[model samples]
Target: MEALQSVYIPGSRFLPTKRNMRMKAIDSEVQHSIRRIVNNRIKAMKAEEGNYDDLLGVMLESNIKESRAREEILNVLGDQNVDTDGLNQLKVVNMIFYEVLRLYPPFVGIARKADKDITFEGFSLPSGTQIALPIILLHYDEQLWGSDANKFKPERFSEGISKATKNQVIYFPFGWGPRICIGQNFALLEAKIALTMILQKFSFELSQSYVHAPHIVLSLQPQYGARLILHKLQ
Candidate 1:
């Protein structure tokens, strides 16, 4: 854990220290292990046509059964290209995106510096004090999001962001206020369009080779990469 933490320390990779070299070696070994696991799973899948009742298998099965977002997309857009008007009508897709962002935010945290002396929640903060807000922690907070905070429930944003967050600043996947991400709308629109296109012509499932090891470098991502089995729709 210490070694892993050291890898993310600013300028650690640029240094010629022995500790950095050891960390790099450890990272390589970890990657090798992940590759082996993926290869073994692929071999197992190829060897048999039997049903997999593993945790991921069961979860995937459940997701397949429960998800109606694709159906909504098909109904809304049909075979036509996604447009701004059609995109606006995709309530379900938007909700799913919001839920996804809430669960797996692109950036794990946000950094800000205090411009002036101020008191927040009774604590006094001087100017130039750098603060790091862990967005994932707030995202999964049970107190703010109820008991199923960690669970994937897109319906939370069915009414809209204001209602879902009760107009609080707790939910800010793309940051909040004036300094919020300028490309937030464009990014979501682009994602919605791309996802709409994909769902229109393909059905996908998590491959048995998929390993759910999410880690953060600059952003939250699958440590070993996301492996999926895509089947084209008729």
Candidate 2:
């Protein structure tokens, strides 16, 4: 992919080359088209009173809805510091984390090698063949996650990961199987603790200048960085 190449190939983005210029033009066009489509959709939604029933419509209809998550955390831990037991009880918070990770997985992809010759979906590959799994693509796949896959509906994980993924290899923010990240639980626990502490004292929203630009270096990151305005709770 050109985007991947731009990141992996040294000096490709900065070099004044034909390929780089073409990529930039293509990227600009894609951005402009996406912006136009979204703006048109917003305008259409405003002009209509009918139900949307699509991803964009759902997103526009959805509200912050963080009160439930905050209330769940408060009920589980009150003003106390987050503990393992309390963290486990914060179901809504856990769902929010799962949804966030699904949308913005830290790693865009994962690499693996076939230990032995294998046949998959009519393709036969010899041993030692390399495979690259695109996590972001899989996460956003409509067939795997239904039509509203792009929306931030955390309730999908309400019944747990198994139900959310239909007992498939579709969802894996920290990779899957035996080679899954060993620190997955620890990392999530750390995040839960930090989030719990913050929610206990403040409410936050995106700042006016915040720009949503998810880019991948080694891992997925916000290109412009996330800017938030936090309000202290009295």
Candidate 3:
């Protein structure tokens, strides 16, 4: 619970303060979804090939810098804690989440219905055939995203999601509106808090033994395993 940089919080300690609750409405659903993904994804990776240390690093950092904020919430959400600051400050966590999702889409493919009729590049499409939105097409789009679109670049999100997507539909790590990922806020909050803690304490990288193939079973996941190493902080 010690302060890492001696940077005191901006507000006073006496009044009944209110934390940012932007994602409060979607907390439950987001919690469930996050749990399923982390658990399943971790399990999918081979035992020796996975990086539990990365998670450890996050925990250490959270312990050192955040204390009361993330820890208390951790009690309620188990290991996950939804925090304020929205998703902007969550660049690193977002990267981890993106890497996880890109490697393992929760739904893989999207299903949609036609309103009437539609046309493609030069073909006429009918209105009845249920169409599938290939998530990978956008997730790995070289045109929309750059060549490293397939690579993990948390810096891309450092400025904002708009910059990452070039303000296009290429970045739907979460989904599009009306029925977009409802719990996105909650999940993101949790991811931010968790990742903030982790990054603050340790550094990490993929191990040489790690594989590149991601498979889709219930979600997109590593076919072999995800291996990474972490170094603890003072």
Poorly placed runs, candidate 1 (over 4 Å): 1-62, 65-67
Query: Best lDDT goes to which candidate?
Result: 2
lDDT of each: 0.82, 0.83, 0.59
Q: What value of lDDT does candidate 1 attain over all alpha carbons? A: 0.82
Clashing residue pairs in candidate 2 (N, C-alpha, C atoms within 3 angstroms): none
Model 2 lDDT tens row, 1-234: 756565466665788789778888999999999898777776665565424577566555332336667888889889987788898888888898999999999997899999999999999989999999999999999999999798777889999989999999988999988889999999999898888898898877767687778898898999989887789988
* TM-scores of the candidates in the order shown: 0.73, 0.73, 0.52
RMSD (Cα, Å) for all candidates, in order, is 16.3, 15.5, 20.7
Lowest lDDT block of 10, candidate 1: 57-66
Candidate 3 lDDT over residue span 1-234, tens digit each = 333655566753333434224344367679999888666545443242333346643333333323433343334343333446343544445555665565356677787876678897896768876877777777777777677675544446656667667787765656676779889888866766666666556556567687779787777778887886877755
Tens digits of per-residue lDDT for model 1 on 95-195? 88999899999898999999999899999999999999999999999999998797777779999999999998888899988889999999999998888
Report the alpha-carbon TM-score of model 2 versus the true structure.
0.73
Residue-pair clashes, model 1? 0
